[model samples]
Target chain A: MIIDPSIIIIEGLKKIIESGPEFKITRFYQSNSITTNVLLHGIDILLVNPRMSKTSQFTKFIHDCRTENENMVIFALQTSYVPMQMMNLVDGVIEMDDDPSVIISKLRNVSCKTESANLSDNCELSSREKEVLVLVAKGKTNKEIAELLNLSVYTVIAHRKNITAKTNIKSVSGLTIYALLNNLISQTEMN
Target chain B: MNKFTGRNKFIELLNYNPQLILMLPRFGMKLGFGEKRVEDICEMNNVSSFMFLLLCNVYSFDDYMPTENEIKDIDANALVKYLIASHDYYLNHRLKHIEKHIGKIAKEAGKIGDVLLNFFKEYESEIATHFKTEEDTIFPYLLSENKQMIPENIDLDTLSRSHGNIGDKLSDLTNIIIKYLPAEIMPNERIGVWFDIIQLSKDLDKHTIVEEKILMPYIEGVKGGSL
Candidate 1:
């Protein structure tokens, strides 16, 4: 599913995606036309513009979308710049300038990664590590995380390093996306 | 007379470089000084007096050169913190504001808008990724007292190369906006977006230079136990 207000770009992107037989556009929606109910239907992947609507409204839309479909791989269709407001809202970003081949590969990779995260029983994160991961994903600093988790600052740092080593996601944003994909942190909790 | 001496002189420095306002809070200082001299304020905040003077010189006069004693007294950690704050200003505030302007311009451009917007987005992503590397990797390494924890392949030159690429992309976007885009629709808005891009480009260049010339060398000195 692709939801961009620009119909021209939507058509262009759709044409590009349809070039590969493996991918299909489930639905197309203008920014204003999309409602919560439409998002309730099963969607494997959703590509949306962060500025499709006002920031608050779009954030609500994302939250509702996540609530409706927990496993939907949501990628922000970056049109102008990196949307910091949408950073915690989406799983990843897919730039509009990306080649069709790159888009297809990214879609495939995200889909597979999300599926594996959901299905994998061997997620080796300890309970404390999981707690730290959630806080880190929520943008808590090491000191804040220490205070929250009742651990020393060094311990929090160590736990974070271990979490990074285990997940192989270096940055907080990457960890946030990972947490969302794996359902470790829900969209509501993120807010 | 040193320009970084009295409280009034500090206020004058702030007027000269308004962007230095962002650095005040990091030092636990604020505007509207009552009776504090620059050295006194630095002492109150536990910040190095010489380091603050060096910053004032570097920011106020582009051609200013640091004395050996001043260079020796410079704290790399403080510099890293200042750099991180500047990055926050760029990523969180300036870039977000500029993006809103670009959004308006894109809406007005119609079909060609998507192409131009995409070009800008690509550039934005590159810069975000570059900052992420510094924030996640470089800054942490510099802050950490443990030298062994520093990654073996973390070369400053390699990182600086990407900074060049970011500048190039910004220039490309600026050119595209100025030359290729149709001027009939929302010309003022388009020019406003371009102006923001230009400002960002200049700021980024200064930032890169600071990191490459000052911060990187300082870190290398510390790594070698020379600082």
Candidate 2:
């Protein structure tokens, strides 16, 4: 998504980012008010104006999207000055003056590998993915898992997606049972 | 590359994808479609050929979405009746078929099987609520004498949003059987149930696409004064 008050800038960003197969403009909002449909598409990367992305109001909306797929990446589509505190919310900034290549590269850099668009036939979960899986199985929210692992929430989400791709497990109950069966977590450890 | 129009023969359509046979009874179609074209069968069954083909497109091709104009031509009553039949088929026939097999599989597998069954039961009730919401609320709005009245509780957006997780659990169930189920416990019966789960998942997904992409858009268009 490219959330900009200016339609012209959104078009420019769409043209630049869509040049690469890595990014496709899924949704754009001229006004800061985004409908709940943002979560519906399982949107992976969000390029929103820094002003709206950091608003105390939109933060909750962004957080609500995490429930769908925690692996979502949000970037600031920078068109003006951004405070450091505001910068904290985004994965990276796509500066307004940057060339199209520069913008696409910045977007692609943060985008995780869609390793299995279709679930992998033989998904071998990484050790970190296993850690995330155990946390997930225990019914820990992504934020809690992120803190426990001493990792960014974004990275934890990426791990979570990879775990799903590998194990084909989705629901917490199923993952918990998976943990129990695989001995990743004992029965007593699960909440 | 194209949709199955009235010109297509029934035998050829079945040959194209035999799984489409599942859609027959839902549309009030029956066996022995010999030498009959799509239109002929629809006429014989008192079904709308366009609606039948529209639904066939939905079931057969993921990329096929009817335009608002195309959807406007459909009889909303026929569409509702089709959806209601689909719900009945799901909750009564398809679900019962799986439950019978899984019931035996659950008995043989013990604790894990019991846990899986309970999860499935939870999913079943959610689906019941989901469909019942449509049947009790949305269906009446379409079929009611008063066309101007907005449904009291359920809206199209809410109906679409609520469709979220009923299908998710099916994936979880299939994965649990395939990836996590102890291989030792009733492997043959387990695999049999797995097949049923997958078939139901795929059908339910198409059912959702019909509701979200076609049905909701039609009603939204109606509200926008195109009806």
Candidate 3:
């Protein structure tokens, strides 16, 4: 899905992308069409230009899209710099002036990353265990995680030990970086 | 004729390959060479003498490859900026023009079109992210004086490895459209889309080769200088 106000950009992306058969353009809409309900269409990726609107609602729209689908890959297309606050909302950012071929190459890379991450959804961690793993990855001590989850320190420790044994990644920093790359924790949350 | 110095007039070279005009606007030169030698014009326009010569030589002579001596003194930063501008032209102007025609084809194809459209979207997003990495991360690292600012895991080899075959998917799409799709709806329009794909695929392949062979190696040399 493409969500940008520029008819030219939307059309340009559609032509270059559809030229190949690997992906399709489900819908292209102006920013006004972006609502929580649009997520129901099962949009896996959204190319948006958040800078089109100066209102605070633009951020909210991005937040809503993310909330609708946690795994949906969102890319911001901007002519100049994308503000740091706006960067946090999307998976990646592309300069509007970038070569169209370069843009296509990026789509391939992100799709592969997304597919691989989805494949790992079948990993052995239970939902509770995954929760504990995320907290640990976020640099929380056992006691802090225990307080947050309302569990005893021993329980948190056990979960941490189990995560290590299961994943064979014992270092806190390793798990933290893993959580980050895997999208288990947002950069904002880490801060 | 010497590929580099033999071409005395800009108009002479422009006459050979009209497409070289694309570089003219970038160099702040307007059409009409006005009887000036390439060297004199480049100097007067504030364009790098080496760059204008190199570009003319590359574009004009078939099978002409730049020797180490040819590009040794060329400014890597200026070359990169020019490459970025080419990228901008494709993304902002050319691709958008192709897209409008695609939208028409998609609307005409009806319910069955959704599948192809979805695939295109996925491909589009992938390309966008790939460029983003280069523009936001790799390019900055190349241009910056502080090599320490680069992430520990990111080296030239790793970055090069990330340049996957984006062209394959486009080929697949072309095959599907040309060989597989039924000819019920606007067959001419479908063929037009295939042509666009072919053009884009060729352009993308050349672009990647230039980056991998020329640009990345140049940056690597610069990085070695800093270290």
Candidate 4:
């Protein structure tokens, strides 16, 4: 989504985005006020020249965009610089004179990050795995966990493999921190 | 990653994954192999190629798993020797090396630095204790000659739990350094410590899996292959 008032800037941005398979043109709104009425559910990113409109209005516009689709990434368009205040309002800034490669790479990075975050969000542990994870974090081996849970050792192993797959955390240290960070174990349980 | 065979050159292993350099010292392997094949080098070092490749696969490939035959053929003595060497290298070499570098940065950062240093010290001691448990109890029981150690707290069920305690501490140390440390305090030094921590964490994790997947099953003498 491009929200610049200038025709040349929009075309240039369009060329930049289309240069890669990573980004696409969603919808363009030359006027910031019009976007408030527009449905933004499907828009993944917004490339807007918030400077075209008043700073105060850009804030409100962005706030409205957030309510409509909070997952959407916003990149403030800048010629030389976007004010530090406005820079805080978006995920990144795209200078008008930025190399096309630079612009694409920045968007690509943000896109990959958003996707991985969604993956983590979807990776919910089953209660049994959570039980296994807390024990594993506490320092229990598979045999002990199996004995404690009254399951076969193989069953415990399967659960561990599943836990690793879902979380994509392969290391014991990684999983332990995962459990700790997720509050499955307390700070005192860190031993 | 393709499974490495005895035909693969020893130096080629490094080319395949440079991080295997860390794995080498554990197996008592040192640099200076110009063009020796894997089996040749293994034979020279008295290291089993089967065990070498299995460890290599684990270290190099993220999703590598040994076949049942591979598991059965694993040289237990060689594996244990490698693991014990790995622990020594980690404790005496890598951890101390990182501590030296991190201590310098920690002192510069003042109070927060002391806290970080102490946090690291706790982790270091915890790792020493963790490895000591295996070295003193588990290894003794596994390598028992008179079969006396098995009857005295010889059960190794607690092995998995201890592995994570140290691993998690290393990771938490990383998180604290990366997330909470003031950016004003040397960024390069912070990154230096951060990289070493991540690398060591990864190396430690690899070490854990070798014990868990290969050694644990081997220890149980479990006839059925699972996990």
Best by TM-score: 2
User: Residue by residue across B40-145, what tens digits does model 1's lDDT show?
Assistant: 7677778777767766665555434455455566676887777777777888888888878877877887755554566566667878888888888787887777
Model 3 docking grade: incorrect
lDDT per residue as tens, model 3, B152-182: 5446554444444355455556655665455
Q: Give the TM-score of candidate 4.
A: 0.53
Per-prediction DockQ comes to 0.01, 0.28, 0.01, 0.02
10 residues in a row with least lDDT, candidate 3 chain B: B159-168
**Deviation from native of the Cα of residue B215 in model 4, angstroms:** 0.8
**Candidates 2 and 4: which is better by DockQ?**
2
Predictions ranked by lDDT, top down? Answer: 2, 4, 1, 3
DockQ of 2: 0.28
**TM-score (chain B only), all candidates:** 0.84, 0.94, 0.77, 0.88
Cα error of candidate 3 at position A45, Å: 37
The predictions' CA RMSDs to the true structure, in order, are 23.0, 7.8, 21.8, 19.3
Instruction: Give the distance in Å from residue A171's predicted Cα in candidate 4 to where it truly belongs.
Output: 17
TM-score result, candidate 1 = 0.49
Please tell me which model should have the higher TM-score, number 1 or number 4.
Answer: 4
CA lDDT of each candidate? Answer: 0.70, 0.76, 0.65, 0.74
Estimate the TM-score for candidate 3.
Answer: 0.47
- Model 4, B71-94: lDDT tens digits are 777665677688789989999999
**If you assessed candidate 2 against the hidden native complex, which CAPRI class would it receive?**
acceptable
